[model samples]
Target: MICMDTTTAALTRDEIARFHQQGYLGPYTACTPEDMAAVRLRIDAEVLTSTGPNPASPLHSRHLDHRPVHDLVTLPGVLGRVRGLLGDDIVLWSTFLFNKEPGTPEVPWHQDIDEWPLDPPVNLSIWMAIDEVTAENSCVQIIPGSHRELLHHVPSRPGMVFSKEIEPGLVDTSGAIDMELAPGEFFLFSEQLMHHSNKNDSNRRRLGLSARYTTPSVNIRDQDSAPCFPGHACVLVSGSDTQGLNRMTEPPA
Candidate 1:
């Protein structure tokens, strides 16, 4: 059962079943576009330029240092849906600010579970669009039911965003679905889901934030901050971390 306050929108059993079957759910509305416009202003004014908690990437883990990011990560609309799958206790392990400018190269298909350092690699990720994401601007794409199996990955070619990617020829994305999102819209996906994005063909920039959550029982590589994670402070977003398995931090004050 989803553990959440009554005010939060909880997913129904059928919705939960579909998520497990398809490895994803939604294009849920987190907020009105106008409100998202206001939030986007704060993201631009206080977030994008800042080096955030993970200054190494300058784009990861801002939830630890920026109120806007923390708020987004803990938003009831998003977190409520996630509780259906991640259970009562949710610990946000990482948040990545994906800023794709014009001419950005494609992010080749990959499974997040393989790249993540967490033991057992159980993760529920929510990707929320902060700016309008369209097909031309390279919105995220995914293969349904792909999470049922983990594909092999190899060294990536030049110009791709990631250093490694799912080996070529193994993926058949002819049935892939492009996840076009509007501002304040978000989708919940499994860490094992196969997802990628094409190069930005338009002049406009696309901004999105990917928040990852797991239970406290899973081990975190909190000290090995590299690649993108810095400081790696996990925030308990729901219920309690009775397992006491990882370091926890309060939301940005």
Candidate 2:
């Protein structure tokens, strides 16, 4: 199911102000709950037939190779908000599925910029829920205004998905907000935001899709420069890549 065009006004001045202050914005509705159910069914089928050993592995960067994901990431509702933050010229840098099955280990607190190689790190990540997310089911939680400066991270504990996590005593998370989202809803956040999730203590699984976007002016390292993956690809989601720094890949037919 395709996302519906958001008729609501683009991020308001107050909303943008809040986002700048808090490092994140919205659980905005992109698709109807019924539409999300259909999309989830299609994603499930793709996962079953995927080549990689697990859903997370095979579906990483699926936006560049999967039609539904390609369309989803480029949806006006998604891009409009991003454009509000990152400007009109946008490059889809990456995509991933963070599907946590019941009893999965908690994701360690970390900042996304630490793993990326872009100079002067700048990125906005849109995380869309494929299933209802709540505190009990490990919805995203983040420390408000943590994106002002890069924080130090240490190696993550065993069984965690990421290799690094925020070092102890670096930032107090006593006021971290639980970002509960319904199916088809999403939030836009700064890549440097210190965020993580708890283990899914509920019976149901938790599923989310993330699309990372950046302006074309940001110079992404080429494949030869310690690439994140051996064959990482990017897509020009909007405007032009005036810098011509990235090797843009065409979306799958």
Candidate 3:
């Protein structure tokens, strides 16, 4: 997952302050309709179809092509926010898509840091919507100002999983912020913040991409790199970057 260097924008002091204060920020848009459509079409055409109870609810790890997702993760604005959250020393650690198909099981309430083992638990997920998502269709629900607490738990299923449970002492936000958005919109959230979505009952499929990035300062040698796809390889499809850090080329499918 290579990306050309682009002029990096630091998350504003205010935005950083806000993220620290709230569990998440957005319903923000990161790509144009056509760009998003191209990615969705590629996903539809290339996904290896499957069906079953995915304990990693809301996500399908095996049926995806990560190379295409690289572009989305490295967009200048997206990267800027990430650097703001994690700092400039960054590396693309993993990527996966969670498609909440109609009638799928509900995404139980949880926190991202609990799901992962990133010590010092400072990370964010850029959740991009591939379809229109809403509370009715099981869009994301977040507990505000909850990232301050560290959590404990097991997987979403009996088998090993990536999410963690809210510690017995913490408050849950699974019923808060019934927010949704159209395709191409996204949100940036802390791994420590408690959040989850509902089962999809609408006629439409609620597909979304989750791309994870780590700060250069963080030691990622032991992380789960297996589920990540080479999704950031096309970071500069719209133009060229003068900075050496911006040179990712999209792979031919």
Candidate 4:
């Protein structure tokens, strides 16, 4: 599958190899652009203004309460690729809407390993665009093969979206690639992959939803944690979670 719109999202050997070498894959179609338009309308009406489970973070865990968000999070084209990478058992530990309106500051150079917390510190994230993401609109950029090494992050500069960021000197900007994506399209990357979005330079807004997936084997810390607060729940997105190592919940009806 060379990034075509196919129901069977199984990866070819070459694709898997490329992912291993480069640390990311896609801009694959998960749903029709028209369908994403409908979802976007609902998100603007219901999700943007409403408070989710985490009061401090309004965009966290909308999949637990919003059916549309859950549907998009578990879309076959997207989840199938995840299943192809992460074996049979999968759990959606968290989903968050990343909306960057015009003037949204740069998200700084950082690996998600610093932002995302898990016992193993490994997970696949599918970031599906809700609004069309373009390089001018601050599309995510990544350094190929950067996931192989873990870098130190210091406190971020003022107006940055992240709390901590890798010092500019530590990252090699020469190989950075832009991950511009269309609405309903997504890319999968390891949590340790080095990625960031620049300041929005265009008038158009950029909105994307990132769903975090992992096998049930990884322990998602609960109750007063950076990744999980009280009332956190992980959805078994595919196959059997016989391990039951984390708190599981049903998707919204």
Candidate 5:
């Protein structure tokens, strides 16, 4: 159930309306360009020494393992906007760093809900730019109003970062909008929105941070009913979970 209180809304009525109509919003700044540059530098160093089994593993859930990420996700500007959309009681379900290095292949068209386990499938994602992102450097692209329904997705081809992609011919791209963002700016979108990024043809690498938030009432379920998916740890970022349904992980020290 949605629990919105307009008096405390982080976004204006107009902004919220646009988001509902377009499936996405912003370029809102959460930090200064200089600050983001420093974050990028630190992430670069950490990536080199990350001991995870694969490159992607280390970048996942940095909010739980890294203090900086935890702080960023909890920032008033970021979390406030999220609260405006999803309500006061929120659970931080996941975080990811999408570092598209030069020459990396495009992220095929897809929806974030395709592989998730949420029973009601209600989620809002905040994608923040860690570096200047432009059309030439693979900025995120989305199809307006596509979040109204789930689209067909097929297994992605080899070498793709995502394992699933929107099936060919299922979506018309005539109204797609490129989400160009400057460093430290962020855009929030629904989990079911049809979105993708192109190959980074520019010489510079494209780095973006994604934080996924949802109401605690949404139950996580899968065919096997596993305790929790590996690396799919969750934490209560705000308010109480009176229903006591989600099993939350403690924030890392």
Candidate 6:
């Protein structure tokens, strides 16, 4: 009989080994069609009322009420993959509804851990695409195994390819993969990896729900605290062990 438990349903050995070697896995589909519909509805509500980009946009923070995005936080498969990476003592640290409208500028090349205040730098980001994400429309570019190396990079121009111009001496991105995700598909990656997205030149807008998870031992800073939706959310799913995972309280910051 097939075991239907999440912990045991963890990623396959090849998957785990690949992640260890490459530092990221998937385009994983965690949400069902119905779930995707619900998420789109919720995001639509925010889009309808929004005056500008979501707070987590790094460039804009207007009309930041992203409460409608709470569902992705409680998603089961997402939490499972997260748990498989970090073990059972997880504490959600932040959430952000990341969006890039047509003509949006290119995000600078940098590691997520560098932007946030954390020690030992062990955290994962789950980037969930709510719309079709393609290389033509400003897809995310990641350094395949850069998570193993730590490099310092200056911020790029608001809408320019900072990585291309300065990355030669700082870090090598030759084997990097430009991830293309569909609605309901997401990628989980470590914060140490060098990653950035180009300006969205496509006619359609590109939207992703980026959620950050940290171990309980990781300390939270006060300033960074206000940015993420506050509070702890625990929605029990399968298994006797909820270790290292649970629902997120805020949408991506």
Backbone clashes (count) for model 5:
0
Question: Residue 77: error of model 5 in Å?
Answer: 0.9
Residue pairs that clash (backbone atoms under 3 angstroms), model 2? none
TM-score, every prediction:
0.95, 0.92, 0.73, 0.95, 0.88, 0.76
* Alpha-carbon RMSD to native, per candidate: 3.3, 2.3, 6.6, 2.9, 5.1, 6.1
**How do all the candidates rank in terms of TM-score, highest first?**
4, 1, 2, 5, 6, 3
- Tens digit per residue, CA lDDT, model 4, 197-238: 999978999999999999988987764576677888889989
- After superposing candidate 2, which stretches have Cα over 4 Å from the reference? 6-9, 52-56, 224-227
Q: After aligning candidate 5 to the native by TM-score, how far in Å is the CA of 89 from where it should be? A: 0.7
* Candidate 6 residue pairs in backbone clash: 56-253, 88-243, 88-244, 89-244, 90-244, 95-251, 95-252, 95-253, 96-252, 96-253
- Highest-lDDT candidate: 4
Which candidate, 1 or 4, would have the higher lDDT against the true structure?
4
* Global lDDT scores for all candidate models: 0.86, 0.82, 0.61, 0.87, 0.79, 0.64
Please write out the lDDT profile of model 2 over residues 55-165, one tens digit for every residue.
Answer: 336867777666877777777778888888888899998888888999998888999988787866888999999889999899999888989888898998788877889
Tell me the lDDT of model 6 at 5: 22
Q: Per-residue lDDT of 171-201 in model 1, one digit per residue for the tens? A: 9998899899998889999989999999998
Query: How do the residues 50-70 of candidate 3 rate in per-residue lDDT, one tens digit apiece?
Result: 321223422443222345565
The 10-residue segment of model 1 with minimum total lDDT is: 1-10
TM-score of 6: 0.76
Question: Cα lDDT of model 2 overall?
Answer: 0.82
lDDT of 5 by residue, 165-240 (tens): 9886897899999899988788899989999988888998888989989898898774133323454557899887
Ten residues in sequence with the least summed lDDT for candidate 2: 47-56
Model 1: residue 164 alpha-carbon error in angstroms: 0.6
Error of 6 at 138 (Å): 1.3
